[model samples]
Target: MAKKLSIIVVLLALMGATAAAQDAKAVLQAAAKGMGTEALKCITYSGTGGYVGIVGQGYSPGDDWPKVELASFSRTINFDARTMREEQVRRQGNYPSRGGGGIPIQGEQRLINLISGNYAWNLQGTNVNPQPAAAATRQLEIWLDPHGFLKGAMAAKDLVGFERYEGGPSREGGFGEKRNILAYTMGKFRIQGSINNQNEVVRVQTFVPTPLLGDTVEEKTYGGYKQFGGVKFPTNFHHHTNWDHEERPQGYFGVRDGGHNSFGITIANVQPNMCGEAVTVPAAVQNTAVPPVRVESQKLADGVFYLTGGSHHSVAVEFSDFVTVVEAPLDEARSLAVIGEVKKLIPNKRIKYVVNTHHHFDHSGGLRTYVHEGAIPVAHRDLVPYYYYAVMDLAPRTLEPDRLSLYPPDEFQETFVLEGVQNDKYTISDGTRIMDLHLVEGNPHAVGMLMVHLPKEKLLIEADLFNPPAASAPLPTTASAANTSLYNNVQRLKLNVAQIVPIHGRVFPWADFVKIAGSGKTN
Candidate 1:
């Protein structure tokens, strides 16, 4: 699943109380006054826009933040309000670009552009009724309230009160919709909006539900604006969700906001007319990718041959003449290829165990494939049950999933094998090399993450943390805190880590980790 941007940026601006006195019609009329009919009817203002939100199972306080940073996306939208003909192009970046392919928003629903006019999909979070449905789904049906906030808001009015805030032409976007707070009896889960003089909604702020945090007034904000051709929309918005690291009373909040969910543009340089075009895979492209090349596989003690996979952070252990692959990095495609390579080396050995480092979607993307291939996943106790019941339960197998969908055998215990080994630990052994799995204590990267240790190889298999660069590339300015904690765990465990195999980066000396952590050295 794609990661949901954080909620910090949503609740940036708060609408004071008292919007309860006004009705929806009054609010729409006043907003239309600011955004003249011309601008509202055929809105066309373009700059750069983005959006952000939170993803993964319900966030746990103190869990590690997302490893791969949230996607920074950009896009533009064009909507001929009169014809309701929308055209859009979405790009992924802080600043919008033209080279990327556009996901068609108009004319089809499945092709909904997150950044363009269809951002209404974000409203899915609002528990809105069935979204406008259709055939192939190349477009989405957005229910616009006759007044302009969101059609669902009308029903929301019964549950919450409405209040209009006093503000002039705003800079968040051009002068559009402003004022009106739909306050709820629960807490500050209000609707803050702005509309142009033409009465078209230029923006709407659906604050995140409060009172969920219990005594914590954590607020989330939403924004929308009308871009090209009078499509009233929420261009700039954010949310303020509670962060895990800080103490309960004295809490620190993380801003989960700012990444465009959809885009539609009319500009020539940016958008190209839609025609059947396949993305060209450039020939003779600069091959910067470091293909995994096996360095050395030494037999340490009986039957325990530590088989290190090529350059990437993958390792294989030979136990009782059978093989157990730990860490399937990249994706299903990569994992599948890796599986072939492993079999080539160890002929006809069924992959008995596929140990997962963590569940960040990427590292474990090929999990289902492993399960289908009959590899019992050695995972954290808390994660196994969720995977079986939730992640592995249903298959929306549109595009091919990384792994085949094979439910465990008939007598299969619903919950797979996931138990703490020692110190919240677990291990897998084939009467050969004992592969120990231990959860990194106090790491924020993931709640129940495992760090693999091969006592015989004296090699540690980890994901995300301390991925040593091939030729000493500059260290990323902001190293993940979760990875840092993994290092701390290594010290706590006092295990001899001769080589550190990172799931993503090239394997490097464990000493490289010491250099970076202790002296802040990258090279």
Candidate 2:
């Protein structure tokens, strides 16, 4: 009886393999024919739609994504030449009481993006700059499009395969339905397509590299298939930037509050075989290159140093035996540079703690680098689960491995979360010197935001709250809501701040902040 059972299991496995192979071949052929993949050389689609800029920046834990308005949008892509161009005009909307760190769309502003091969550049009005990371991201976006992936997969049959599964909930069906998946890998990224029984591609999902969240998810869905000039295409489409989490060995977790990065339009026009077009690199962009990381240190007090040389800044505070650095901004490169500088200034002290101001991608991108140096991250209590599960544990750094990925897990110290329940303020002291981390209460910019204070020095360290305008530039007539909130919090906390050190801009007097914040008096 045992032998008979073994034979039955073997037969079932063989049947499943055979079914998968057959389905894969048939589905590819059908999709290729229906989409006109054979005759297609190049395609261009244009439409006017709305866009959201860095939607996650406006989101807080447990809150829905804030909404903004994009007045106009258009995009053009050439498959054969491997180029893409986008033009957009955007504006701010009446939601999400406050905004932070993104293109301030208060008035109508025009922006353009151009990508060719491994190069990317942006043109905002007259200014042009090179964007290597954006270009890499665009390459993935081009290949992951439903029609584009189908066409590419047909030519690379060796890398493609199919699997059958019991149906899950989909737009067409309510729940517990049967579905088929076509899976493939491109470089270090994985792509999956959901195919309906009619051999039509319903959805495509893939992962993209990110600075803050590690591996971010991108998913697009298609429907309303219609024939256009002898080829079948989806008339209605939608694309989400970071709506889902990448599956990890431990489990799946996402840092975003389930918000979409952007959405697509109902394509109004499609033109094929319009070739010979390429992106021309401007002289300014062609000559520009990334500069080496440099750190400029200014001694603010006996044991405190203001580290600056780039757009973002960090403050290093020396304890009796160890050092604490505030705000690890940007990526590994920036963090590594700051770490080297800290070591030089503070001679023999090891960096024992990194105090994160907030969880915005830009500010917290380099926290992992400090973790590699065995430093505990001191952040808000609300971000504990997200930091441990999503940021530290599940993030796949295959594209660019950091210190944590290079060494054993035991080499790093545990992360520290400042629970508001026990104490709204977290103090790190060594009997002589003390640094207090306080929650910026009632601020609309971010949830669980933190600011560092040195009472003895009369110094305050913050980010994205009120970036002081340069001494030569003019001040605004009215204060922004975010700035007002930060000012009110400072007054409420009764912090005796004499100087201000901001993460984004130059250090200025506390009186300048009060002036820009529209408060009648200074501290």
Q: What would the TM-score be for candidate 1 when compared with the true structure?
A: 0.50
In candidate 2, stretches whose alpha carbon ends up further than 4 angstroms from where it belongs are 1-25, 53-58, 165-180, 243-261, 273-277, 287-289, 394-396, 411-422, 519-523
Writing each residue's lDDT as its tens digit, candidate 2 over 222-267 gives 8777777766667667777675432323444344354554565676
Candidate 2: deviation at residue 438, Å? 1.9
Per-candidate total of colliding backbone pairs: 90, 2
Best by TM-score: 2
Query: In terms of lDDT, which candidate is strongest?
Result: 2
- List the candidates' TM-scores in order: 0.50, 0.86
The local distance difference test score of each candidate is: 0.45, 0.73
